[model samples]
Target: MDTNETTATTLQTKQHFEVLDGLRGVAALAVVTFHFMEWVYTDSSKNFIGHGFLAVDFFFCLSGFVIGYAYDDRISKMGILNFLVSRIIRLHPLVVAGSILGLLAFLFDPFGGHPELYSTGKIILTFFCSIFLIPLPVIADRGFNLFSFNAPAWSLFWEYIANIVYAFVLYRIGRSYLLLLTILSALAICYIGYRSGNLLGGWSGPTFWDGSVRISFSFLAGLLIYRSNWIIKNKLSFIGLSILLLLAFIMPSSKWNWLSEPLVVLFYFPILIALGAGATLTPVWKKICVFSGKISYPLYMTHYAVLWMFGNYYTSHKPGTTQLVLIVIAGLILLVGFAYLVMVIYDIPLRKYLSNKRNERLAKQKAGLI
Candidate 1:
């Protein structure tokens, strides 16, 4: 998931919607739990959080809503170049760090598998490409997929494409046209999800189009929700909303007669976002929201690399239920701690530095000093 900022005017006039922020964190955490379960079960159908990958779609919708909320008013003034720069500053730092972590993990376990898989030169190449969020071609012989260092980076690549679409095309379109696009994207989502039998096909090379359709539908739906200024007026419980989101992710797709993923993406998620927008939090809930928002992005971008480490350990050891449970508990703590540490030590500081640099550059450009 990505974080977005408000325009100067919106910043002055609009209250930050903390519920959406908290939901993002909730979804990220679900993803982490899902991955942990996936490694343990090694069977998608048997996994506990069977539909947790839907969190990625939730993330796409959230990104669209926040981006539209933040930038819709200022698109004309900000210009495409500036908008792209702003997104890069917000998203690229953790991406680079994640890739580096992935590379280190690979280096430490280079000989664990087929020695011919990734040569040192190939690993270095993957590292360099990953920093720029490039998806390398999959090497079937070696079982390599794009962003080999960190698989989750695949979503960030699509997110960048969606950002470009927003800045260049979607921002300028009339509401009617945008609505048409949203409807078409929704249909695409249903069709793709039905054909694939699941919504989990997006991270690999052959199924990249499946991923594309998934993002397009959710992102556009989110953009439409923001543009329509839709929100539930009745007081909604933050805890209730949180539970609904978790259930949406945790429920098995087959439990809803195999229609859960499509229904959730096409209807539930957008409705959820609207309801979340209207949520008013108590002081305690407010702090929860703030802390959740602070760690959501870092958790998402960093957890997979840690998971890889966990997977390595799991494969090497044989543990009983109690021992396995302890490992899971400790792993969760370590993942959360690492995500927060990255936020405090790297993500926040790097974004701030990049933002300051962008401001300086923009100042220079305005002053004809560039």
Candidate 2:
């Protein structure tokens, strides 16, 4: 533990975080694939390669780990308000922009299709649910129904839920208690997912409870990984991915399905830890994954809308595979471009303003009278 060794380790850790970011990019791609391929998935077998929904889970778990690492000190000292402000500022701007874009996309579908998709009830509800990030099954049941708008944003609801739990319960209780609570909560979600009959109902069903129960494991598993100091070294990424793939395939689709939920929960933890670990272990991975991580949020938020726009255009023409591929590529380009635009225009500026305002108010309050 001399200075040289410490210096080398520090550099490695920084590199690893960059790789974790790249994995975030990978996760983003997964979900985007899932969205783009949803129409053709039946033909492609149930394998569902894009299965980006799983990426959302990865993001949540990653968030739990990153938040634990990033704000453990802040939570320990200045408390929850500042922690919450930072999160809100970071999250809300993109969310708002995504929602607006989604609304516009749905409103102007290429075929002039499903205008009522933006009916008063639906529009108001979607806006309201999104504002709170309440995992409402607003449009998922439609199944290739691009009209419901902002389909992927559903996961953000659970993100908010997990954050609330983290801020109030997990942080206050300390890592040990947080671990206990996460385990217990994960078990509860598993039971609910099992009892509720697989929990993936048609878009018409109530989304809040079903999705929250199904995905809480992602967040909890993340917290578990973060609390353990062993994860810092990059020893476990591929081993974790293999286990998840094995379980995802071998595990039956049966309701409650034996160890399905727990398996998923178990599989997810290691996969993410391994992802974080690999960045530490390998330089190449670190370089690619970190770039992906930086654009990950915007990619996740904008991809669905971009897909809907381009996918609708292609579906109308009934293009050849080459055309579809070109369209898909175009869609991806637009997705990333739009995401970056929203991030730069609405997301970054508002976040800076809000964060600054919050910090200034906090500073003033500390001096006595506000």
Candidate 3:
């Protein structure tokens, strides 16, 4: 979810695993495609990319590895405050962008929705909670999602929780304690799977705590991979690893979802992360991987606004199978392009300005102290 380079003197990760970065983009694309497929296949078993939701788990695992690799040795010197500030700069710009886009889609969704049903005050309150990452699952129309305007922000909420825990607790702990915690989280994941029949319960109000469980194991496993040096040296290039990664998402759905989903989350995703970190990146694929990595977060954060529109369009029009295919294919391409535009026009420049401003303040404060 972060970048390949460390532009800041101390805040950025020293080096990135380019293959891992490229995998993030692949996961993000899978997620969007899955979202589109999900609407049509209300019974998820029929969805071709039934397991695409696991991409979020992959993301959590990758985030943990990236965070540990980036901050394990440096967080103490940077101090908790600076570390968190850096995280906010790295992550929150898109959070705000997503919220704003979600709100606009809500207010003006031409295909469907009843904006007049809610008063201005409630809408305003919901928007505030969303931008601040406060959960208010109050909108029935939006399936009582933790963040009504932006459904995917649910993961971001847990991501913030993980970041806070890292600053206050996870960073100081030894690998032994971290391993114990990871094991506990793995159990929680299994329990959730057995109880719920799948690993897909974290976005809405009823399944609120499921988000916590999902992030727990994957993120911890990721951190564990980094600390344990679990990188498996492999000849799999970016394209090879990508095809392998896509298999998990495209796997068939069946009665074993309860067991299968957790296994993938607990083991398969961690292995992918390890392989991705160690995989070779050919010179030919380096630029593609970089762009994929750079565009991933923006794509993830921004694509949902139009999802609502698509859902509305589908419900009202009930387009035929061929039309649906065309729409989804076109939607994916357009969304990717739109995400890139937003990344260039808004997210990157805003983050850069904030980073520069924060760096200057740090310099002035150091000068004053001297």
Best by lDDT: 3
Q: List the residue pairs that clash in candidate 1.
A: none
- Expressed as tens digits, the lDDT of each residue in 152-254 for candidate 1 is 8888989999999998899999878989999999888778767777778777777878879988998998999998888776487777888999988767546
Provide the RMSD of all predictions against the true structure, rounded to 1 decimal: 3.4, 5.9, 2.9
For each predicted model, how many residue pairs clash, with residues at least 3 apart or on different chains? 0, 12, 0
Residue range 14-129, candidate 3, lDDT tens digits = 55688998999999999999999888999888899999999999999999999998889878877899889999999999999999999999999999998889999999999999
Better of 1 and 3 by TM-score: 3
lDDT of 3: 0.92
Backbone clashes in model 3, listed as residue pairs:
none
Reference-based TM-score of each model: 0.93, 0.78, 0.96
Give lDDT per model, in order: 0.81, 0.61, 0.92
Backbone clash total, candidate 2: 12
The weakest ten consecutive residues by lDDT in model 3 span: 1-10
TM-score between candidate 2 and the true structure: 0.78
Score candidate 3 by TM-score against the native.
0.96
Residue 306 error, candidate 1, Å: 1.6
Models sorted by lDDT, best on top:
3, 1, 2
